[model samples]
Target chain A: MLLQIIVNGILKGGLYALMALGMSLIWGVMDIINIAHGAFIMLGAYCTYWLFNLWGVDPFISLFLSIIFMFIIGYGIQRYLINLVIRATIFITLILAFGIEIFINNLALVMWTADVRKVQVPYGASNFSIGCVTIPYVRLGAFFIALVIALVFYFVLNKTRTGRSIRATAQDLDAARLVGVDVAKTYALTFGMGVGAAGAAGTLWAVLFPINPMMGGILTLKSFVVVIIGGLGTMFGPIIGGLTLGVAEALGSNWFGTTYENFISFTILVLVLIFLPKGILGKSE
Target chain B: MAQRGATTKKLILGILIIAGIAIPFFSGNFIIRFFTNTLMFAVLASAWNIIGGYTGYASFGNVVFLGIGAYVSAVLMEKGGVPFWLAFPASGFGAAIFAVLIGLPVLRLKGHYFAIATLGVAEAMKALVDNLEITEGNSGIYLPMMNLSVKAQYIFFYFMMMGVLTLTLVVTYIMLKKKLGYGLIAIREDEEAANSLGVNATLFKVTSFALSGFFSGLAGSLYAFQQGFIKPESVFDVGVTVKMIVMAVFGGIGSLLGPLLGALSIEVISEILTNYFLVAHTLFFGAIVILAIVFTPKGIMDIISGRKKFGINYLLQNIRDHRV
Candidate 1:
């Protein structure tokens, strides 16, 4: 029973890790909390839902389309709106992002009518059992995609020229500028990539769970919990954090009832924030 | 010139105070209820200003105090057979103690960490309240309604909320002029420097948090009694915190009159928008927030105080200062 629970947790954790990746990038690079991170994810899920329902495209095929569309929107938001208050107090940026979230959420509500949506793929219900453990094909597929995206994200951050420029700017804005890196463009690109990751995660999320405009709020809080537990700036941090939270929440719900699920997550978050400010794998600043 | 300006300021203040006291008597029930609701928000925003604006700790969990206060007062009145007058003060005290207990450890963290930690606390508290048997396990609790006429009830709550607002403003005025307020401001400017200058950062931060909690609790207690019902969803709602913070920011953070002005204007504006646009009001509100932050980051107080001129050049300068 425990093994099956753990497996379920691991599957869920993979997606949670992917969800936190975009938020972590934005936080580490721009020093903004990106309160609108989950809004972008909701937007991505809607994009995938529309593509599937309208054109009958498979979610897997439309994932790339969602990413591209979200990237452009993300890029524009940062370049035009967020950049205007990028240099203000941290709370200013926080509030600004919050405004963006409110705007996006209300817009979604107006357009989508607060309807819960799901992606009904052909193999959504197909599951295989290995001994006593059952694994849904859709969940397994989502997990695999999450892993691939995380790997690709890690590679891009470490190996590419644009990645190098992004790192340089994150490290020292003036130095990066002096080195001929266009700081504004680099910031916008970083934000775009972060939003793209959110879009990809949202697509996978729609496959596994129901999607709605209000879903983003809890997800944003959960992503923050994952990020804090996983540590900031490290590639593997969110993965580790996500898995831990997933397993812990599963165990907590099992023991204390499902009503305590949020209670458990938030309690863990506070304890972690107090005791392990840097996270489990984070380095001392 | 300075003497004349001070005299005029005092004259305006006196007139506003008199008008505030006389408002409920002259206004109808609808207007009285509207202003009372406005007063409640003003108190909330003013409470938030004590910690978030003056002390520079942007707590995202101030609603926790509101929830705690509501529960406390509800339990005291309904379960303990306490009167509203006694239950109200007890609620404030209860929230203050909770603030101090949680603030000690939580205030150690800085910036976004503090905000997020507070957010977690509020969520955790809501969950706790949801599961607790005393809170009726999310079915919520009801307070004893006062045996009064409808007009009398309206006037009673209005005066109650107005009195609380007056107390908040007066306390804020005195605190800002005293050493404790200076210590808080010093901490806001630079905590490390304040600590080095012999200011106890932890004590001051916790104290400011407690003060903020105390007033928020009072507001919540009144809110519970006025509504005659309490629920985890209603009192602990994150939306309440957002409204208070936005009002504080919209008026001007760190200023005495900023939150008051912000709360009054925003509440009125939102009410108008709700009446006219209905569904699309929030969308417009979101846009207003975005435009306000982008254009007037310092808030309306700066413009009113003439510290920042409201013009094209000023707006352009603000953008230039912060834009990438």
Candidate 2:
């Protein structure tokens, strides 16, 4: 039983890592918490849902489309809306992101209503067993896909010129400017990349769970817990954080029932903030 | 000339207070209820100003206090058979005590960490209330309706909320002029410097939080009594916190009059939109928040106080200063 639960948690944790990666990247690069991170995820889910329902596109295939769509949206938001207050106090940026969240959520509500949706892929129920441990095929596929994307993200950040420029801008905006980097464009591109990751995560999430316009709020908070647990400024932080949270939450729900799930996540967040303010792997300033 | 300006300000304030007190006498029930709601938000924004604006600790979960106060007042009146008058103050104290307990450890963190911690606290509190038996779990609690006419009840709640608003404003006004206020401002400007100057940062922060809790709790208590029903979702809604933050920021973060102006204007705008646009009100509200933050990040108080010029140049300057 314990092994099965751990397996389940690890599977879920992979996607959680994908979810937090976008938020962590945005926070690390811009020093702004994108409160709309989950909303972007929701949009991605709807995007996948529609493509699958309207044209019978597989979720896996539509994932790339969602990324492209959401990247443009994220890039535009940062360029026009968020860039306007990028240098203000954290509170202003936070509030601005919150406004964006509200706008997107309501817009989605108007467009699609609050009905929960699911991606009914053909292999959704298929599972495999290994030594009394059962794993859903879709889940395993999602896990592999998530890891692959995360690996690609890592490669992009470490091995590319754009990644270098983004890192330089995050490190020192003025120095990057002096080095002929277009700081504004880099910021926008970084935001776009972060949101594209969110879009990819959302497509995977739609296959695993029900999708709705209001699903983003809790996901956003959950990503926060994951990011904070894993620590920031490191590539593998979201992975570590997501696994820890998923395992802990699975254990907690097993012991205390599913009703205590939210409480457990939030308690862990507070405890982490109090005990490990820099997060598990975060470097001290 | 400065003294004359002060007197003029005082005259305007007096007249406004008088008009506020006389509002219910002539206004219809809907208008009276609207004003009461506006006053409640004003109190919330102003209370938030004490910690977020002046002390520079932006609390994202202040609705926890509101939820606590509502539950406390509800349980006292419905289960314990306590009078509203007694239950009201008890609710305030209960929330204040909770603030101190939570604020001690939570306030140790700074900036976004503190804000997120507070948000977690609010969520945790809501979950707790959702599961707890004494609060009746998620089924919610309903208070005994006041045995009075509809008009009388509306008027009564209006006065109650108005009285709380008056108390909040007076307390804030006095606090901002005293040692506590100066200490908090010093902390806001530079916490490390304030600590080095023997400002007792923790005490001031906790005290500010407690005071903020006190007023917000009172507002929640009045809200519970006015509505006659309380639920975890209704009282502890994060939307309330968002509204408070938006109002406080819209008017001005650190000023005494900013939240009041913000609440009044935002509420009025919201009311108008709700009446006319109905389904799109929230969308418009969100758009307004975005525009307000982008254009006037310093807030309307900046323009009113003449700290910023009201022109396209000022708007462009703000964007230039803040944008990448």
Candidate 3:
């Protein structure tokens, strides 16, 4: 039972980490809460769904094209629209993000009409048994891809100049600008990068779960929980937070029934907020 | 003299009150419903402003109060068999009581922490109501709306709404004149300084949150009873609470009249737009949100008061202030 739970948690944690990675990147670098993040994820899911249904593209291969598509969309949006009120208070950012969420959701509604869409691969039901526990192929594939993305993210953030610029911007915007950094382009790039991460997560989610316009809100909240739990702004935060929450949720559901599963992340968020806001792995020094 | 300020306030109040009393008789039922929704929102915005505007504490998750009020009143009347007259107030109080109780712990966190905690609570409420069997989970229990007349319920709620709005406005006005309201404004402007000045910061903030929670809960109950059914999606909606905050900000955040005006104007504008062009309604709202923030950061109230006149030059000034 424990092994099965661990397997289930790791798979779910992969997607959570994928979603939270974008959130962490954007939030850590740009200091923008990016409330419309979930919508971007939703958009990614749709792109994959249609690409699969229409063009017979597998979810994994479709990810590259979806990432590019969402990247451009996110870049255009941030540069043209979000940058307009980037100077306002945190409250205004919150409001504008909400407005964007509404607009995106409505746009999705117009296109897809709120139908729950999914990527129906031939191997959705296929799995392998190891010892006494069974593991699903899709879940395993997702977990593998998640590890790849995490490693790539670690490489880019640490080894690359643009990634360093993003990190510098997150740490101190004025200092980065003083050193002749083009903060606007960096901000846009970071946002696009965030959206690209969502696209990756979306493809994975579309295969494992279903898609809808409303999925963004919960995903956003979950991302926050993951980021908060794993400690904010750290590249590896999502991996730790996601695994902890996924496993905790699994245990909670198994014991408290599926109904209580919904409250698990929220409860963790509140407890973290109240008791240890910096999170378990939060850096004090 | 304070007399002059009082008189100006009184005259404005007189005109608004007179208009409110006369509007129902003058308008058709459709118009009445629209105004009823606008006024109800006004009450909500006013309630939200007490916490968000005065205290600088943004609550992105207040919709559950309405849901609770709705469900409490709804379940009681629908299942426990209470009458509307008894049910609605009970529902409102149910939320109010919960707010005070929860506010005890959650309100201790400062700034964004409080906001995030409130959001967590709202999300939890959504999960709870959707999952709990006693609330019938997601199936949604039907209120006994067929037995009552819609217009009649509308009028009763309108009056009730007016009464609540008046109460909120009056209380806010009185508090603004006293140390408590002054302390709240000071806190919003600069909490550190306010604390230095010996303001009972914690007491006043908690009080304001409870007050805001109470009226919003009342409004929520009324909203539910009028709608004839309750659902978790609508009740625990972050969007609705955020809309109230926007309305308050758009009209003016710190003033009594700002929230009322913001709610009415935004709702009316969105309704008209949606009525004419349903597809572009959200687009228009989004545009307004962006424009309102970019241009009138202090809200339309300030624009009307000549604090910052809206024009090309004002736009330039805003860019100067906000551009990174």
Candidate 4:
């Protein structure tokens, strides 16, 4: 039972951590919380759903189109609306994020109404059984993709020059200016990258969960919880945080009968704020 | 006897209070009920300002304390068969303890994390309350009351809201007098600098959060008492949280009159529009919030204080950084 639960949690956590990675990137490097991160994910899921249903596109093939579509939207949004307040206070940025979130939700309600959409791929729910544990294929595939993304992000930030400039600007824009990097482009790129990650997570989420306009609210909260527990800006923090949170939630529901499951993350969030302000890992990178 | 500005403020407040108290008399039963809901929301918005505006913590979880207060009052009144007056304080007690417990951790995280933590706590509380048997679960619980009337409820609820708003302003005035309030402002401006300057950032934040929680709980109890109904969805609501934060931000964070002015004026406008246009009220309010943030990032106080400089400065700043 323990092994099965642990495995289930790890699979879910990997995907959640990937979502957290997108959130953490915008927060850590871009210095904007991007409250609309989950909305972008919702949009991506819808995009994937339509492509799979209408165009005979597989989930994996449609992932590329979703990324491309989201990248343009993300870049345009950041360059136009978000950059206006890059020099403003964090409060302004927060409001901007919220304003956009409300706008998107309302727009989506007008366009699509409040219906739930499902993305049913071939054998979407197929699972393998081993020693009394069931592992779903789609969940496993999502986890594999999340791992791949994290590894690629790790390599880009660790070894590349543009990544170096992003790191430099995140640390200190003034210092980065002296070192000759386009801070504006870097910020936009970081935001685009964050949204791209959101797209990937949305595809995964579309496979397992139902999608709606306001679905972003809960995912946004989950990402924050994952980000907080993992610590800000830490590449591997989301992976650790996501797994811990997923398992703890699973355990909480098991022990306290699901009523306390939501409370567990919050209780842990409160504890993290009080005792582990720097996050559980005490590392950002 | 005519103290001019003071008398003017007192006159406006008196008229607003009278109008609020006389709401059920002027409108239909449904309108009366809706106005009551708006007034309840106003009280919540004002209570939120005590900590959010003053301390700058951006607590996205203020609804949790509201839930605590509502649950406490409802449980005591319905389950324990306590009177309205006594049950109200029971609500406060629950909120106070919850605020302290949750605030201890959430208040420590800075910036976005603090906001997210509060939101998580709020959402978590809702889910927890939803499944708890004591609160009657997702099906909801009905209040056992002794003749609850909409008119009588409005009169008392008016006083409740007016009283909390007055208390908030008075407490704010008192805090701003000495070094304690200044300590909070210092932390808001720069936490590390404030700490270096001998301000105990932790204590101040935790205390302010508790104070905010206490009053929000008070408002919640008043809400439950007035409605004779309490539910986890409305009590610990995300929409309520957003409204509070938006109200504070729209008026002028860090100012006493700002939140009150913002809540009352915005709500009054919403009420008026809803009276005439009904369904358009939500979309209109949404637009107002967006416009408020875009045009006046510093809020109404900033516009009022620096009316002459608004446009010129906006243009100047944009021109100076033409990278736009």
TM-score of each: 0.98, 0.98, 0.94, 0.90
Cα shift from native, residue A88, model 4 (Å):
2.5
| lDDT of candidate 3 over A103-132, digit per residue (tens) | 887778777887787789998999999997
- How much of the true contact map at the interface does candidate 1 reproduce, as a fraction? 0.78
Q: Residue A28 CA error for candidate 4 (Å)?
A: 0.7
lDDT (tens digit, per residue) of candidate 4 on B122-212: 8878887888888998777777655646566655566676576666667767877867689888887888999999998888888778778
Candidate 4 residues lying further than 4 Å off, grouped into runs, are: A130-132, B1-35, B146-148, B191-202, B268-288, B306-324
Interface RMSD (Å), every candidate: 0.7, 0.7, 1.9, 3.4
Query: How would you encode candidate 4's per-residue C-alpha lDDT over A135-203 as one tens digit per residue?
Result: 998888889989898888888877999789889988988899888898878888888888988888888
Clashing pairs in 2: none
lDDT by residue for model 1 over B257-296, one digit each (tens)? Answer: 8888888889888889889998889988888889888988
Per-residue lDDT over B1-324 for candidate 3, one digit per residue giving the tens place of the 0 to 100 score: 445555655676688789899888777778778888888889889989988888888877777677788888878888888888788778767887888777777877765567778888888888888888888887776787746476676677678778878887898888889988889999889888999999988787888887888788878777877788778887788888888988998988888899998998899899988998876678678777877877776777666565444688987786567666
DockQ of 4: 0.41
lDDT of 2 by residue, A119-201 (tens): 99998999999999999999999889888988988999999999999999999999999999998899999999999999999
Q: What is the lDDT of residue B112 in candidate 2?
A: 86
Off-target runs (Cα >4 Å) in candidate 2 are: B1-15
Native-to-model Cα distance after best TM-score fit, residue B168 in candidate 3, in Å:
1.3
C-alpha RMSD of each candidate structure in angstroms: 1.5, 1.5, 2.6, 3.5
